[model samples]
Target: MNMLKYPTLLTALCVSTMLLAQKAKPVKQGNKSHTDVATVEYLPEFTREVPAESGSVFKIKNKRYNLEIRLWDQKKVRIVSTVPMGSDTDTLTNDELYKMSGVTLSAFGKRIDLASDEYPENRVAEVTNIQVQGLPAQPAKNRQDANGAEEIVVEGYKTTTKKQQANVGEVTVVGYKKGGTDSSGKTPSAFPNRPVKDEPASIYGTQNPQVADVVVTGYKSTWTRTSSTRRNMVVYIPRDCKLVVDNRYTDIVVNEDLDKAEFTLYRSNLGLRNVNELRVDASFYTMYAGNLGYADLKLASGSLTAGTIDNAQIESTGSEVEYEGGNTLFLKSKADRINVENVGSVGGYKEFGELRIGKLSQDLTLEGKSTHVKIRQITSEVTAIRISTQFADLRLPLKQLTGYDIDFKGDNSTVYSSFEKKEMNANAGIANSESLVAAGVTFGNKAPAAFHVKSDESAGKKTSFNITCNNCTVDFK
Candidate 1:
């Protein structure tokens, strides 16, 4: 966040709304080209300084800079680079820099404010005078100009302006909001080399914007690509610093135990030995770790492998996971495939996924729909079992369930066990949709599908089941 200081006219835009407008003399906004104003120049050699406190945060923002972070005894971060770029400046325009960036405006009157991708979101001399100055002529589609906004489509740009009256309450803005995050944590430039003009619609009059005045500043910047390819960085960071990273597709490795690591990743991969705690919000992420004291993860379309986590809370979609074991596990998943070799206790809900557990020692409580659950062993440490699922499959070994008093209930699901299962309800009417199944399975419109089971022994630990099914054929072995 250490950017160069700018004059009051550059780098800030506010479009706050619902403010009461007032009657003020309208200073006609003048039309001016961005090229006539300030131009930002980037230095080739950049150094980021980290504070020597434990609360210091080191952020890796730009994707062009590839980095490897390692722990060191030094209190401050140190960067080692070979053949660093000379003091020359590389220039990039607002068009290339803010291409796919979202609109970042604050402070708006109760009127229309139109913005388009044709103009830079943070550039100088934009949104000037009548009809947005410096824009090339565009084709008029015979559309009526209403609400003080005139539709004008110029070459490679299309937008509207509404600054005609302070009472303007609505607007049409285009272009600057097309894409999501890129490699860098910043938004890509929304405009092109040829800039466009956006009209403020209305900023004065009885509009009661109520503020002294709405001041939107823009800066001038330039980007010139260099062929040096001198982006690889090796930095030694203090182990005590708390790191918050927004990472892209780079592979990051931390060789030692980290104090704490929290990050948001996109298509990135990471490897860590150990952490005090790790919190991640990611998509398309791949992580490999030795052990974590605690882990809270929300993921989509990726994979996670860890050795032992003391506590794990995860929510995933279409992801794969493999773990050795943990103290406790809580999961909510959809279309995920997970394998846990051993754990103290487990509780979760899933849909259309597969969960395989080698051993559950303490207790197990899970409920879901259309899911496949398999447990190799549920030891004597488990004193209670409460499982409820519909249209789901469950497979458990005979040893764990042998000494328990079980209560099972279902509508149309099948059950198999070592002892004789007392049927609580059988041959009950279910959904009429079962008529599409085998011909002789139903009595006219009613499908004979209800089922329930209870162990005859009343001695051992308690096991309970509650199920409601429609067209669900579950086989419990």
Candidate 2:
């Protein structure tokens, strides 16, 4: 064989072997080449323009993918994706890829920000002002239903009629009729009549000469008497009227706001779907409300349970008040137990009672005399906490007091926390035999004071706690 022919055959064999090796290699999962070749299709699901004064939110969604672009305070633009992630490229659709790898370019006035998780240096595209459509107008009341059904409009109080049956009695009478002969045609009488009596005793008494069984026809009539009965009707309150509930021995139930004010009191249930303000003053009764825009309540000896009140001014004397949720609460009471949970900005004063707050979203100002207070969770928005009590034991779970400035003043009262003894300042001028002060123990700061407790790094905003007690011991962890 020629040497050139052998060289050409060897070169061809080496090239074929390289191609076979490449084909035998396994492909890695989630490769871009594995994605479906079809282009992504987007359909408009819904567009919502949030009602706000300073900020605006425009949302666009398609199927299971949602892209929300929010302009907060006209200064920042946030693009959020609510689509779930897929395991591999084959499982992920084009919509998912658009959400995961898309960039958001928004401009407000002359300021613009480009935000994206992928391709940070990509060219920015100019965008025009987005035109947002307002919500659809609601139909008027008493209008026909959307499903082509006739709506029955009922106004005023409902009426019900009832009837009563009449009474009846029965009686029997006896009478006689005689058979007569012809008068002038030589007719004789069958039997001659003896006598007829006109007095009552002859008809009903003894010594009767003749007796005969007579058939008497008597008429008996039946009559019906009807009487109308009406129930106690409810008084409809106007929508704009402020609800003033003042009653004794009556329990009131307040349902959700149906753009009206509806209340059930005693035996009457009235609905006024337009009331926005509520004021209640009742004693020896109980009131329950679902939600109120604004409320002013005063109770001498009763209980009030409410779901949420936007703003409230509450006063109670020897009564229980339970507020499940609210924004602002201004409370003043004496000798009563008050429990409020999930509230923001609470300022109150209590005397000779117990107060328990589950969670606070903002600030808290409390001043009490001889009262027990317990707070479960205080958020980062709380800047300062001040408590002044006399002759009462104050217990606060130390876990809730992380990164707070604690100041306590009391006479013959005890203050205790979950912090250890070595984690407190305890070096103030009041740290004598009679007074124990735990102060200047800064948490989350680089330079710590004497006996400083280092809170968890993940704690929220730093707060200051100034507590004052009389004749008491202060302890912290």
The number of the candidate with the highest TM-score is: 1
What's the C-alpha lDDT at position 326 in model 2? 80
TM-score of each: 0.54, 0.41
Compared with the true structure, all predictions reach lDDT values of: 0.52, 0.41
The alpha-carbon lDDT assigned to residue 349 of candidate 1 equals 89
Candidate 2's TM-score reads 0.41
RMSD for each model, in Å, please? 17.7, 35.5
Candidate 2, superposed: residue stretches over 4 Å from native: 1-231, 237-275, 400-402, 418-460, 471-477
- Residue-wise C-alpha lDDT for candidate 1, range 1-477, written one tens digit per residue: 333554332333221222212111121222221111112223233233233545456554423334577887766665533222112224643333323222121112221111112223333222221133333233222112221222222111112333333432212222111122224534223442322222111222111100111111211111111113213456677777666666654566777888788878776787889887899888888989899899999989999999998899989999999999988999899999999999888888888888888988887787788778788887766766666777766765546554554444556655554444433333433222232122233232222443333444444554443444444543344
> What is the C-alpha lDDT profile of model 2 across 56-130, one tens digit per residue?
222111111111111123323333332222122355454444444343434454333333321111211110111
Angstrom error of the Cα, residue 197, model 1: value is 18
